[model samples]
Target: MAQVASLFTLFTHHAKTFRDLVYSLRNSLLKTGVFTNEKVAEQQVVSVINFDIHLRRDADGHRYIERITECVPVEQEAGYPETFRHKTTTEEKMTAFMETMLEYFRRSTDRPLYVARNVIEYRDGSYVAVHPLSERSRKEIAACLAGPDQAAFEAFLAVHWGDSDEN
Candidate 1:
């Protein structure tokens, strides 16, 4: 079947943020038998998703975008730190392992699949940037563009990310 297309997909949902939206999506898909395994379904959602934007309204019914959040995948780049690998003593290894666990616990959320960061936020009657896009997302977005737009968006990303390598 043929269907109309847009530059990006859109869905009107009651999710308050990226985290909420992902959790809701997983639950809905599982409950309806769209997917059976919780872990697999969550990974599917997070792996394909990039950002979620929330909108807000005032008493007068004027609507504005509240925030734009990116769904950050679990970063495994930490790998094996030299210091951690060099720990030869049992006590040292125990402490290192404990520290790693502590760090994980600190960032753990109710839905620990992804960490949502607000890349853009509305504040004081204006929209402002809060965080920059991850390099992976930047590259993915760039790959979807062409011609002048590709060049222009790349420039914006270079400046926004504050790193030429990111674009």
Candidate 2:
């Protein structure tokens, strides 16, 4: 029981640490961009860590995980914060919107593609593992980054085919 409790604590801490690490890296990237002045909040691609532990007859247990999903905006529903507001008098609403589009591009395609799961291999050379991305999802991610607007790209797809289809 104590071991299980300790493991849970470790897992939660892993989530917080991962979130902070990604946030720091993202802030650094946005600052260096040409449109740095454009927005306050940037999208963070997140991975949901779902871990399963199974105990064997020998009392040796292991964990398994799902594949890495592509990036989605950090605050998809909340949108940008007030801090992203334009400072210059010359900046118009449209400019802000365009700046947003640009910011989205910079974030959605930048470095640190995968958020590694917290699992670590034990001394016995056995690992409670995490997933690697599949080839199909990787290609879709690339295609999304290649376009100007992600929403527009999705809209184009929706118009032609349908949203229910994953591919």
lDDT of each: 0.74, 0.41
Q: On a 0 to 100 scale, what is the lDDT of residue 149 in model 1? A: 86
lDDT of 2 by residue, 83-145 (tens): 336545445656766777776776556633443343332335454322332334434544656
Q: Give the alpha carbon lDDT tens digit for every residue of 41-142 in model 1.
A: 787778656778788998999999999888888753454333555699989988887787666665543336677888889999887867788777877787
TM per candidate comes to: 0.69, 0.23
Residue range with the least summed lDDT across 10 consecutive positions in model 1: 1-10
Using lDDT as the measure, the top candidate is 1
